[model samples]
Target chain A: MQVLYFAWVRERIGVPREEVETSAATVADLVEELSAREERYAVAFADRAALRVAVDQTLTDFDASLDGAREVAFFPPMTGG
Target chain B: MRIVVQDAPFDLGEEAGRFAQADAGVGAVVTFTGIVRNTAAGDLKAMEIEHYPGMTEAALTEIAERAQTRWSLSDVLVIHRHGHLTPGEMIMMVATAAPHRADAFAAAEYLMDYLKSRAPFWKREITADGAAWVDAKDEDEAALDRW
Candidate 1:
């Protein structure tokens, strides 16, 4: 599966996107997997309270199932004009 | 529904006129323009905006769709600017047209709220001392939860 980062999360992660192989079934599970990757990933996925997740471009909860999702994105709560 | 995510400034009057007159049945048109400010936290001087190419438009469209679903809007126009922006310049516009004032107002507010909490744009501010990225605000998200 592909994971995307946007806004300051990208700046922190040092990459706009990444491909990860995970057996995670839900968005929360995916975050747990990514948080274990490295220090940067850990920092990005740390404090899930401050983050927002989208499965396949639709805003969703962390408990939402990612059964057939091709893409998952994580970023801070948006602040666009 | 016209959605334009561009890097140029737009005329509010012209855009509002076009959106309102597009359909004779549109009795109300509500438009909101967000502007770049010269000061932030009382010291910022200038600001620059960055966005993900494909993702920015996609997120904005999703916000527009949400507004449409919640309101009896006849049409929606969303125009957001990117690249370098100056203080007092327009950052974005959300215009909603409907047969009644309620629909237009609701849709316009919904569009702004969703954009504030969902759009994929980042702001970088340059102060007298240095430059830094702006963090997302919790209050912005809390504002969306009211609706």
Candidate 2:
């Protein structure tokens, strides 16, 4: 599956997108897995309350199922318009 | 409905002029334009907007569809720009046309409210000292409760 980060999350993660080989069933599980990989991921995922998630390009909660999903994105609350 | 997510700057007058005035039944046309502004310190140089390419369009379309379903709107137009934008430049605009003033006004406000928080766009301010991301406001999120 592919995971993406945006805004300051992208800055902190040091990459916008990456293809991850994981068997996580939910967004939270995926975050936990990623956070375990390195220090930057740990820091970026430290405060889950400050982040938003999207599963397959649709806005969703961290508990959302990643069943058959191709993409997941994490970012701060949008500040558009 | 016209939805435009572009990197090029748009002229409000030209876009407003091209809006659908052809339908005589459309009695009220309400428009709102968002402009970039310097910080209170007045040292900001530009606002860099970043957006999720595919998701931005999809999210905007969903918001527009919701507006149309909730109101008796004849037309809706949304235009947003991404990339480096200087202070005072227009960032985005929404125009709503309806048979009555009430629906037009309500739908326009709804669109603005949703676009501000729902769309997958982020804004960063570039100042003389440094650059920083603009934080989302609680009021912007609360505005959706009115609908």
Candidate 3:
């Protein structure tokens, strides 16, 4: 699967996207796995309140099922207009 | 319905003109343009907007579709720009055409409200000191409760 970071999360994570091999069943499990990999990931995922997640291309909650999902994105709440 | 997500600046007048000429029965057209504003400190240089390429178009189309379903809209147009933009530059615009003024105005407002928070774009304000990501206001999210 491809995990993507955007905006401040991208800066904190130090990469825009990365391929990860995981058997996680949900977005939260994936985040937990990543957070254990490095300090940057932990810092980026520290405050869940400041972050938003998207499974595939659709905005969803952290508990959203990742069944057959190929892409996951994490970013701050959108500031578009 | 037309949803455009691009990095290049768009011509508001031309887009509005084209949207207003939707159909003979269309009696009202409403357009809202969002501009990049400088920081309150007034030292901002530019605004950098980043967006999920594939998701932006999809999300915007969904919002436009919802607006159309909620209101009696004859036509809808949404154009949002990403990448670097100077203060005061147009960032995006939404135009709605309907058989009556009330529906046109309401639908246009609905599009703006949803586009502000639902879209994938994120804005970073560049100042002389440094750059900072703009936080999504709580009011922006709460605004959706009206619908």
Chain A TM-score compared with the true chain A, each model in order: 0.92, 0.98, 0.98
Share of native interface contacts present in candidate 2: 0.91
The sequence of per-residue lDDT tens digits that candidate 1 reaches over residues B16-92 is: 88787899888898999998877646776777887766777888887888888888888999998888887888889
Q: Write the per-residue lDDT of candidate 3 for residues B47-146, one digit (tens) a residue.
A: 9999999999999999999988889989999999999999999999999999999999999889988898999999998898888899999999999999
Candidate DockQ values, in order, are: 0.59, 0.95, 0.94
Give the TM-score, chain B only, in order for the candidates.
0.93, 0.97, 0.97
For model 3, which pairs clash? none
Rank by DockQ, descending? 2, 3, 1
**Which DockQ value does candidate 3 get?**
0.94
Worst 10 residues of 3 chain B by lDDT: B35-44
- The C-alpha stretches of model 3 lying farther than 4 A from their native spots are none
Number of backbone collisions per candidate: 0, 0, 0
Candidate 1's DockQ is 0.59
> DockQ winner among the candidates?
2
Better candidate number, 2 or 3, judged by DockQ = 2
Model 2 over residues B1-85: C-alpha lDDT tens digits?
Answer: 9999999999899888778565678888999999998799999899999999999999999999999999999999999999999
Q: Candidate 2 — what's its lDDT?
A: 0.95
User: For candidate 3, lDDT tens digit of each residue in A1-81?
Assistant: 999999999999999999999999999999999899899999999999999999999999999999999999999999999
Docking outcome class, model 1: medium
Residue A51: error of model 2 in Å? Answer: 0.3
